[model samples]
Target: MNIRITLDGKEIETTAGTLLVDVAADNGVYIPTLCYQRGKPCLGTCRACSVRVNGNVMASCTVPVAEGMTVEVDAADLNDMRKALVELLFAEGNHNCPSCEKSGRCELQAVGYEVGMLVSRFPYRFPPRTREHVAKYIWLERDRCIFCQRCVEFVRDHETGRKIFTIDDRGTHASIEIDVALADRMPPEQVREAAELCPVGCIIAKGVGYDKPIGQRKFEVKSIRERTLERSRK
Candidate 1:
C-alpha cells in the first residue's frame, strides 16, 4: 500500500510504514543523516535528520509515512536549526579538522559544509579525553567522538553477538568503550568495518593514515548532497 504526503510543499507517494528519510530520499529530497544506515534499526541517536512533520520537529528516520502528512524539509528555520546542530557537534567535541585523518571523508565534516557552518555560536567545550590503542588493528581517539553510537549498535562480535563498542557513563561524561577480548578477536574485515562505521576520526585503523590524500577524498570531490542525490537518481 502507498501513502501520500506533502514534503516541502511537494506531494510524495511512498509505501506505508516507510521511514520519512527514505521517502524523502526516494523523491530526491536529502535529509542529512549521521547515525542512520539503511537496513539497520533506527537509533535516533544523532538527531541530525530532524525535520518538521505536521508542524512538529521529529527525527526523520524514526517517523513513518502517513497519508496527508505535511513535512517541511527545506524550511529556512529548520535549516538554521540544522546548522546550529552541526555547530553544536563541532563545539562539543575536539574536532580539529585540519589535523584529523578523517577530514574529508568524515560525515560530520561533510554535514558541516553542507549546512554552511562558518563558526560555532557556542563556546568550544574542548573536554579532556583519553586515547586508547589497546587493539592491535585499531585505535580510539576519544576526543573526536560525537557519541553517535554507530559502533555500539552496529559492530558486534560475530561469534558471540557481543558489542565491541559500548558506552560508559551517561550524558556529557559518557565515553565509548571497547570489549578488548572481542576487539582483539575481530577479523580484518570487521576491523575495517568498525573504522568505517565511525562518522569521525575517533575510530582509527592502526596502520593507515592519509591513504586517499587531500584532494582525492570522499567529500572533497563531491558534496554530500550531490553524492546522495546521485544515488537516488540511479
Candidate 2:
C-alpha cells in the first residue's frame, strides 16, 4: 500500500505500516523519541515523540501513515508540548542527570536538551524513593520510573517468554512489578538487557558504574539517531 504524506512541508511516499518516526527520519526530518525502540513494540507512553498530525498532538511511534496525511515535525507548539512533557518527567522522577552515570548517554537528557528545557516549570514532587535489589548485580529505582514499560515488556516477551513483569497501582502510584516475589529470579543477562532498555536510569546494572568514562561513551560523540542506527546494525 502506498501513502502520500506531507512531513515538514514536503510530500513523501511511504508504506502503510511505517511509523511516523521512521517516516520522518527517512525524509531527514527527525522526530525526537525516548521510549521508542526500533524492531520492538510501540509503547507510546512517552509523549516525547508526539507530533502534530493534521492538528492534534499524537504519539508518532504508534501513529500509522495514511494517504494524504499532513504531519508536522518539531512545530513550535509541538516542541513546547514535548518540552513540557520532558519537564514533567524530570519533576516526577529522581533524574539527577549531572550525577547519574548515564549522564551524557541518557535518552531523557538528550531529549531534554533537544527540546531546550532549561528549567522545570512545575514544582518538584521529590517523592519517596524505593528500590528493588535483585541479587548483587541489579537494582530497580521506582522513584525514577517514567512508566515507559520497556523493561516490563522486554522481560515478559523477549526474555522470560512469560508475564513476569507488570505495572501495579494507577495514576502517579503506578509501578513495575515482578511476578515472582523473589528478586534475581530472572537471568542476569536478561536483567541487564531490561535495565539497558530503559530510556531513563530507572534500572541500572549493579556494579558497572562509569566503567566507560566520559570521553568514551557512545552518546558523547553521536546523536541519538546515529547511536540507535549503529545499534540496529549490530
Candidate 3:
C-alpha cells in the first residue's frame, strides 16, 4: 500500500515500510551514503546518510518510512554534519587521492566532493598502516579502508558461504582481515567484484593497476549523484 510522507517539506507517496533512504531517492531527493547499498541489507556503518525524521536525527538507510513522517534532507545543519563525517574519514585515513589508484572512482572521494569538504577540521592522525599484497588476486590497502564492511558482509566465499573478509580486533585497534586461502581460490571475476565492492581503494585486484585513464574513470564519466539516483530508481 502507498503511504504519504513529508520529505524536505514536500509530500511524497511511497510503499509503506520501504527504507527511508530509498523513498527519498525515488522522490528525487539525494542522500549521500557510503555503507548503504540499494537492494542490499543496510549496514549503517558510515552514518553518512543522516537525516531528520520527525525532528529526530537518524541514519536514513536504517529507517523505514511511516505515514506522515516528516523528513528533512536539504537542511543546512544536516549537510554540515555529513560534511564533518567525510572530513573525519579523511583525517583518520591515509587517503592520498592524487597518488591512490582509485582516485577518480573512489566513493569516499566522490562523497567528500559532494559534501563540499575542502579540508578536514579534525587533526590528521597519519596512523601507521601496512598495505597487504600477499593474496594471489587481491591487494588489501589497509590505509584507505574506512571499515564500511561491505566486503565483509556482502562478498563471501561462493561455495562455503563463509565470510572471505573479516574484521580483526575491536575499537581503535580493529583491522580488516582477508582469508588468503579463500581469496586465492576465488575466480577472477569474483576477485574483481570484491575489489569493486569496496567504497574506497582498500580491496583491489592485483593485476589491474590504473587500467582506465583519469578522464574516463567511473565518477569522472558521471557524478556519484547521477549514478546514485539512477541506481535508486532502478
Best by lDDT: 3
Tens-place lDDT per residue, model 2, 1-234, is: 987899888888899878887777776666778888877879888878899899877999998888888898767888888899999999987788767767777788877877889999999888886777654556666767888877766666444377656789998787776664333566777667776787777677788777677767757778776664455445
Lowest lDDT 10-residue stretch of candidate 1: 225-234
lDDT of 1 by residue, 1-234 (tens): 887899999887788899888788878888888888766789999888999999999999999898899999898999989889889999998999989988999999999888889999999999999998888788999999989899998898999898889999998989988888889999999898888889999999988887898899999899888887777667
Quality of model 2 by C-alpha lDDT: 0.77
Off by over 4 Å in 1: none
Give a tens-digit lDDT track for model 3, residues 1-234.
888999988887899999999988888888999998899999999999999999999999999998989999999999999999999999997889988888899999999989999999999999898878888999999999999999999998999999999989987687899999999999998998888999999998987889889799999999999998898778
What RMSD, rounded to one decimal, does every model reach?
Answer: 1.0, 2.5, 0.8
Error of 3 at 50 (Å): 0.3
Clashing pairs in 3: none
Query: Please, what is the TM-score per model?
Result: 0.97, 0.89, 0.98
TM-score of 1: 0.97
Error of 2 at 228 (Å): 5.0
Off by over 4 Å in 2: 134-136, 157-160, 179-183, 228-234
